[model samples]
Target: MNREAGMILISTMLMLALLALLVVSQMQTVFLVYKSLNRLVDKHQSFYQLEMIAQKLSSFNNNQLQAACLVTEKNPDEVFTLLKNGKACSLSYEQQSFFYLIEELGFFPCMQTVKEKGIYSTQHWRLTVLAKDERFNFLQLRIARIAPFIRCEKKPLVFIHTGIISWRYLVR
Candidate 1:
């Protein structure tokens, strides 16, 4: 009887130890899952903010000489002023809000000037956008151009003109 009681006590202790280990592992898994989910949420928020900033930048006219001039100044300290839907505005990104800036601007030509002598002055705009959140960061660069201008002759000539206007982004 004494031997049986001792064996039972030892078995009970072993079972309790196993249960504690299982519980600890489960808790660790739960914690890791929660951390991953939080990171995902932060990434999603950053993407949303970046998309918003891109849309806002896209709405501006690429042909606007004034805006292009502002870009040429290349002043990191100067905030480019823009008018959207008749309202004056500027872009900013913040942790609680969204933060954005124009990183680069340049001209992209569609065709070789030597080959197409007067076909088009230039052909594409390159815009680089950077987006960031607590967990992740994204860089999106896009080339944009005006609709092709068609010239009818013995052969139709198409000319597309574009210039780098602005790059925008948001960070949190």
Candidate 2:
């Protein structure tokens, strides 16, 4: 009877040990999941903030936008200074800062004015945005926009040609 009792006690302890290990592994998995989910949320928030900044940049006047941009080749591979106005946005994390750089890729010549009403031209612009945070999380966004502008002779009226505008957004 005593031998049988000892065997039963050992078996129970072994089962408990295995159960404990399984529980610990499950807890670790849950923690990992939580961490990944948190990172995903942060990335999503960063993307949306960049989108808002892009919209703001697109709405700026041509001259103001030109003044704020750096002219670059269509295939820029070097680093350049960002204009001071790039840091004017209010959307940022506590330990993070957001900056943007605009590059005017090309401006095609305006079509010859036949009518007295107006002349039209198309401009190609690229906007690049970067967000850096304390956690070493970095986000970059690139937007390519083709803006058509119309100028009138009578009143010096300038209008953005909304009908032919094209925009492309990319995130990295």
Per-model lDDT = 0.46, 0.53
Error of 2 at 133 (Å): 2.3
Q: Model 1: runs farther than 4 Å from truth? A: 62-90, 93-122, 132-136, 147-172
What's the TM-score of each model vs. the native? 0.55, 0.63
- What does each candidate score in C-alpha RMSD? 8.4, 7.6
TM-score of 1: 0.55
RMSD of 1: 8.4
Candidate 2 ranges beyond 4 A from true positions? 65-68, 79-96, 109-120, 134-172
lDDT: worst 10-residue window of model 1: 80-89
The residue pairs in collision within model 1 are: 93-98, 93-99, 93-100, 94-98, 94-99, 100-169
